[model samples]
Target: MFLPDVHAEPDTEVLFQFIKENPLGLLITGINSTSVDFLQCTHAPFVLDLPNAGDNTTPRLRAHVAKQNPQVKAMIETLDTKPSETITLDQEVLVLFNGRHDHYVTPKFYTETKPDTGKVVPTWNYSAVQIYGKLSLYYDSKTPETGAFLGKQMHDLSEQCERSVMGFTGDGDRPQPWKVSDAPERYVELLQRNVVGIEIEIRKVEGKFKMSQEMRPGDREGVVKGVSRALTQVGVTCMGIHLYVPRQ
Candidate 1:
């Protein structure tokens, strides 16, 4: 999360939007004295639990994941050995959500288009966000509560997915659409057995939007147009594609 001033995004709205758009996150933690224990999780859009009046310093995050996932096992193992290391109900963790990115930026796109004198090399532009917070893991004693939480999380995720992808027409609006109760008992039991609820308290957030912000206006415009055309040729849309436009 080394965010240079040129690419730093301090706006909270922008950071939240990035997280909402990219719900899938990479949860990294040090395990077994190594820094490589990472879990790629499709996290449900979680709420930041903030203190009301007196307690404003500590913030927490809330989400859930499958209990059967290996990351949970790793966490449990870590907790068992080092109880002190276990993330408390309000301990912050780092959550990283990455957006679409690709290589293959050609210098010709900017250099040839712009009236530049010096030579220019290829570069790539992308966006990403790092959220630091504590997490809370929740478990239900009764099947009803478990079903309710799981159902709500799943429904929210499905709605997000549908809204993001175009041409989705599956139960967009319903007061009581597809509840866990609609499914068979066995399915609900299976979900209850496998799912693990998660909550994270975010203390700080860092966002990097490296979308040709360092380039001159003309150079940036050229790059945007070039990248857009190139991506379209390959049937893709890249970051900052909408930012480039020809002036009258």
Candidate 2:
């Protein structure tokens, strides 16, 4: 991920919060040094669980993918392979969550502060988190244990979104939050059969907040104002973006 020390975010809370806000993570597998053809990727929604987080516990991510997904087959192959003298059955994968709006900044944005410098170039501003974990695939989604797990995953993910900026909550004017049980039981059961559950025991996590933290103070504010005006023109609010200002 090429995370520099200057832009690195080492806080566990911040990483977890980013995953919660951006649950639709990209699951990447089959990262072999030999060939790129073996690589696989799947876009899936996830539920972050940090049960023992206070004690420096590693987080567990829960999500489900269609049974017919090619990535599912690749992971199962890893599980079925027996460890020999040089091989092991363990499969590690990456899940990437892109959490915020990314916009391009032009040199013109910094021209006011550095009129003759000509130092600023085009760059992008964004926030993202990368999670690396060992894959644990559950094939029996219909069993009581797996079914319960899937149910909880569905509930937690939907409820979290209900309370998010793009979602609705039953306040005075908004409609009530929706639930998984709102669907017909028979239909839900049929739908469940086509998917398999995935649980990731996270081994490591990294966060990158590239919000012009390295730029000069005046140039930083100028870039922010330029992007804000552009976003507002398109009816998009920019209140939630966290700004990074140098400490005095």
Candidate 3:
């Protein structure tokens, strides 16, 4: 995450939009002690609780993981020392969301398009966001609260994904989107036993958008058209080709 000042993206709106579009984030956890090299990483779909633009409240990431996951066991082990603490707020973790589209840029694209510009070189165009926060695990291995918490995560996650694609219409003619409540109550109860809920309260978020903004004017436009054409050929919708130039 070595973000140069030129590459840094401070736009909060763009950052959240990127996260919503790419909800599947990689979660990395490390122990509190400096001597420990133990690190746990998991990939899960996260639902963001992003407050209003001017609001000062911290954002949170909500998601769940399988109960059998080793990271779950690792967190439980780490929290054993503080039995009274239901939520482990002291442990910071990292969550990463990769951009939806990324492509390599060849100097040939620039050289051929702009024959006079020999200054162009190869580069990569991509977008990425890194979130740092304290992870709060919400499952008491022995209590009913565990099932309830896990169930809520499942329900919310399902609805989020469904709504993004196509929400339930309640019409008999069209096939209804699947929901957590659609499953049998007993089956859901049993299903919840196999997973646990987690939430990360975000302390910091950073976005890096490298889309040839630093290149010469001719070279920059060449990249956009070249990348767009290449993406269309492969049947992929181009996501972000950021060309925002920061004021000097």
Candidate 4:
């Protein structure tokens, strides 16, 4: 939650694009203020309802969790307090998405600038985005509105994951993307009974990319080489990666 200005990214479209690439998010909820379960975190892959590049409308996040998941209970309880005249901060939830290209920087990587001062230390280089929002839950596909909402979420989420994560094009020579309609209506209905749909009206979003850019050019190159060499040994490619400290 602490974001330093030098590390902060003011361009939201860039941040949203990062989420589109890395759609799995860690959902955070602070439920009962005085209870042990106050801080709740859940991990799930979500599809974003991002608006056009220049639109002023707020974006949203859509995902579903198992009906029996403990986090569901927490979210349901939070939504129940909307009638209160004074809205509390606990009602807002956070979804954190981290970029894929991240690595650790060791003092050893400071080949060019180190060995002179012997003052370098180890730090992590990573990129992350935090999104805060008020979430609404849909319990079932029983009503017209609820049915449409649940159905669209399932279908769209499936297609998006297929196209984005699975590399299915749903056209051309690539493999065809799958959709919720691929299954029997009754089967889909049966599955829906065991889960709850979640929609978050995003209130705020912030991205931090801490990649050791603050260091000298020589040190930055050293980090890239160190990470790339380490990853190459493990059959991974980590050529260029950057992350930032928290902002002001």
lDDT of each: 0.61, 0.76, 0.78, 0.79
Model 4 scores a TM of 0.87
Please give each candidate's TM-score.
0.72, 0.86, 0.83, 0.87
RMSD of 1: 5.4
Give the best candidate by lDDT: 4
Clashing pairs in 2: none
lDDT of 2 by residue, 62-137 (tens): 8888977877666554444431111222767899999658888887777455686776688888888999988766
Off by over 4 Å in 2: 31-37, 53-57, 81-89, 165-167
| Order of candidate numbers by TM-score, starting with the best | 4, 2, 3, 1
Q: Please give the range of 10 consecutive residues that has the lowest summed lDDT in model 2.
A: 80-89
Query: What RMSD value applies to candidate 4?
Result: 4.2
lDDT for each residue of candidate 3 in 153-223, tens digit (9 for 90 to 100): 88888888886746564576655668998889888877666667788888899999887777676777778
Question: How well is each residue in 18-128 modelled by candidate 1, as lDDT tens digits?
Answer: 776677777654444232255434444554444667975665555667765666665665553432232353234678788766445566666544445656767777779
lDDT of 4 by residue, 112-190 (tens): 6696787789998888999999887777566565567778889888888998889999577899988788899899998
